[model samples]
Target: MEPNNEQAQGLYRLCYRLTNVIYPGWQYRPIQLVRIDERTGNVYVLAGESDFEIKPTGGYEP
Candidate 1:
């Protein structure tokens, strides 16, 4: 799917503010470019060794 700049930026802001563990460099941890599922509106982010799946409704699914 084509990457959405606005979507990723918004998600990054939300995640960083909500978790404080996802940010620029995460202050030391690794931060990778996020991937989004255009079909399901699911966002995937990898930080260090952690993986997150953010739902469209601003929810996290396990």
Candidate 2:
């Protein structure tokens, strides 16, 4: 999928705020924004299925 500059900027800002990590440099994988229904807690990734969550494990490096 094509990168959305606005979304990318928002993601980068959020990343920096949360972890002090700059995107596309500090992160190895493509990071995406997701939305969840507060009532249902159903999560939806912004860039569709191409950008889904990968839970970090104990041995996870990125």
Candidate 3:
């Protein structure tokens, strides 16, 4: 159950765009990619040494 080249590439593009929004001015690196849980539909994006957790709770925090 592995993604094909095209699927992988598309996921990478998606990760890049999402990361750019969350962390402005981010340039894609070799480690960046999107991970999904096929059963739960949970998506995670690579960020630094860990994956950026997408949480539903929203508000401005600084």
Error of 2 at 23 (Å): 17
**What clash count goes with each model?**
0, 0, 0
For each candidate, give its TM-score against the true structure.
0.51, 0.31, 0.36
lDDT of 1 at 49: 65
Q: How accurate is candidate 1 locally (lDDT)?
A: 0.62
- On the 0 to 100 scale, the lDDT of residue 15 in model 1 is 59
lDDT of 3 by residue, 1-62 (tens): 34445545555555665456466565544346556556544445665565653322211111
Q: Write the per-residue lDDT of candidate 1 for residues 1-62, one digit (tens) a residue.
A: 64356555657665565456545444544556578878877788776667767766555542
Model 1 spans > 4 angstroms off: 1-10, 13-28
Please identify model 3 stretches exceeding 4 Å from their true place.
22-62
- Prediction RMSDs, each to the true structure: 5.4, 10.8, 7.9
What are the lDDT figures for the candidates, one per model? 0.62, 0.39, 0.48
- The best candidate by TM-score is 1
Q: Give the best candidate by lDDT.
A: 1
Candidate 3 is scored at a TM of: 0.36
| Per-residue lDDT over 14-59 for candidate 2, one digit per residue giving the tens place of the 0 to 100 score | 4454444454544333335655445543333444224432222111
